[model samples]
Target: MRLVFGLVLIAGVALAGGAVYMARDYIAQYQDQLARERQATKDALANVKSVPTVGVIVTNRAMKYGEPLVKDDVRIVNWPEDAIPEGSFVDMAILFPEDANGERFVLRAVEKDEALMKVKVTKPGQAAGLVSQIEKGMRAFAISVDVSSGVSGFLRPGDSVDVYWTGSVSREFEGGGGEITRLIQTNIELIAVDQIAGSDVTGATIARTVTVAATPEQIAALAQAQNTGQLSLALVGVQDDTVATAVEVDQRKLLNLKESAPAPAPVAEKVCTVNTRRGGEIVKTQIPCTN
Candidate 1:
């Protein structure tokens, strides 16, 4: 029994030693493979060159029009130095001179990571108001609006609209004066609803007045038309840039009334006068006139 136990112990020891040797060899192979992978990765990285970049300021969050800008609303990212955009700001002081605080506003909606440009933001310390939204060389003009005329108060800032003038065409024309509604402007962009300049798209409240961006000529024309007649707005879609044809409606046209023939022209009248003279005194007699 002792001899058999000794032989069994020897066999168990040899099996244990063999298992340990195999384990060590497996670990060594794994280490060698890992080292080779590490060197290969390093070589690949060395061959790949990275372009140098410069820091640029951009909006940290998506911003809406007329919203005040703050330090938290912006961030800096490494931009390709060769691809820097014009008017991009690289330093905080340049974008917010004198520590403008929250006085600066975005004139238009800016997405996250969009480059902060001087043209996209209002002047330092200036609020994004109706004037900022107004394009250069353009003026703002407000006209009274109501439920029927203002698309049931669905009109919002930044919406395009068509303006119409409704009143009598001529007060002293034949057959009395005719009422007419004519389109005065087309594709006019509304800058504000009441006093708010930002886009208030919610139709929760009705706006009493809507302001529109207009040129000097348009302003003058609208000013005169507003006084001469009742001006109304027809809301147009933002994507709709279709040019509207001249649209005019009168009572005759609305009811499909036949146009009356023009009145006959009047003839000029002729008159003759005879003069009788005695010495230096003279007497004149008038004759009847005929057409």
Candidate 2:
């Protein structure tokens, strides 16, 4: 009996140890499975965030193509909550409205290849299109006479003015005669203000100055007018079609005189003769005329 009891006690102890070992193994296996599941969940979340979406606003307009998409401008719609921004630096493809014809539109940002908004191309105080008739080498005349200010130094280079000068105008008449009239150098371009405080007439203060340009003949007339009667500079608008047409007519007349008058007669060449004396007998010999 004593032997049987001892054996039974040993068997019971072995079964308890085996049960403890099994429980430990099962717990370890469960913990490992739980850790793997947590890792998989994290990976899934990262993948979901990486998926691209539509209508995402990109703020950086300077971004080029083929770059990684990043979050910028706000996302609009049709995008997953975890989706990454698409086209962080994409060239926007715009579908302009038909009524917006002739108007320029610049894309500041884009999402899913769609334009977000129009950007301002010009800056403040910047003049667009062609300059307001104020260009280099252009001629202008002073409108007001500011002799005290050296011919109105208050004026500017870009400023437009009306030049008033009086001079005796001499022109060829129809019958080989000439006629003189009071010539006035009206609207003229002011290229430079010589003898003035500064080259630019935009704003200055001087007196008794002279101006120069490509065509100073008109200014010379104005100077003559100043000597005779009164030379005045009138600030006015730019030259229009009418004034340009008159200038063109004057230029055409100066260029083509045949259109204005009849052609002159061709002059005839004179002949000469040489007299030769042969033994007191006079002989006349004709010489060929050369032009």
Candidate 3:
């Protein structure tokens, strides 16, 4: 019995030693693989050429029209050197020049990560108000409107509309007057609502007056039309670029009057006159003439 117990103990010790050796070998193999992978990554990185870059000022968050451009609203990011945008600001001094009196406003709405350009912002000390938004050779004209005529207050700045005149026309002769509704202006750009020029307004606005940018000729026509009749505005889609030719509708046309066909032009009856053979005295008599 003593011999058998000693033999079993020797076998168990040998088996345990073999298992330990195998575990150590497996761990060392994994460690060597990790070291080799790290070396390969270093070699790959060393061969890549670094791209040249420059600091560019970009909007940190979205900005709406009429909002002032502040230091906190923008930040500098490293942009590729070759693709730097025009009018980009590289430093704080250039962005907010000391002579500007710290008054820089956003001319248009800017989105996140958008680079700031001089054209996108207003001039130094110039407010992003309605006056600044007017286009060259255009005047801002205000017209009265309500919820019914104002597109249910869905109108905002930068939206285009079609103006219509609806009223009866005064005529000098009886039955010459008629009530008509016609499109006076098409694709007119709205520049303001009440006094607000920014479309970032919180609630729906049924502006009592809408200011539109128009040429002098348009302004003159609109002034006369507004006084002659009630002006109604039709909202136009942003993508609607085509101006309708002549959209005029009277009460008769709107009701689709299938009036009688125009009466045929009247034909005059042919009459032949025969001269009497009295010397100096001449008398004429009508006789039936055949075609």
Alpha carbon lDDT at 75, candidate 2: 36
Give the Cα lDDT of each candidate. 0.85, 0.45, 0.89
Model 3 misplaced stretches (Cα beyond 4 Å): 1-8, 28-52, 59-73, 80-88, 107-114, 169-177, 241-243, 261-291
Which parts of model 1 have CA positions greater than 4 angstroms off? 59-75, 81-86, 96-115, 125-129, 152-154, 164-183, 200-204, 224-291
**After superposition, which runs of candidate 2 have C-alpha atoms over 4 Å from their true positions?**
1-153, 166-183, 194-204, 214-220, 223-227, 238-291
| Clashes (N, CA, C under 3 Å) per candidate | 0, 18, 0
Model 3 earns a TM-score of: 0.70
**Best by TM-score, which number?**
3
List RMSD in Å for every model shown. Answer: 10.6, 24.0, 6.2
C-alpha TM-scores of all predictions: 0.61, 0.25, 0.70
- The candidate 1 region of ten consecutive residues with least summed lDDT is 196-205
Position 196, candidate 1: lDDT: 74
Q: What is the lDDT of residue 141 in candidate 3?
A: 97
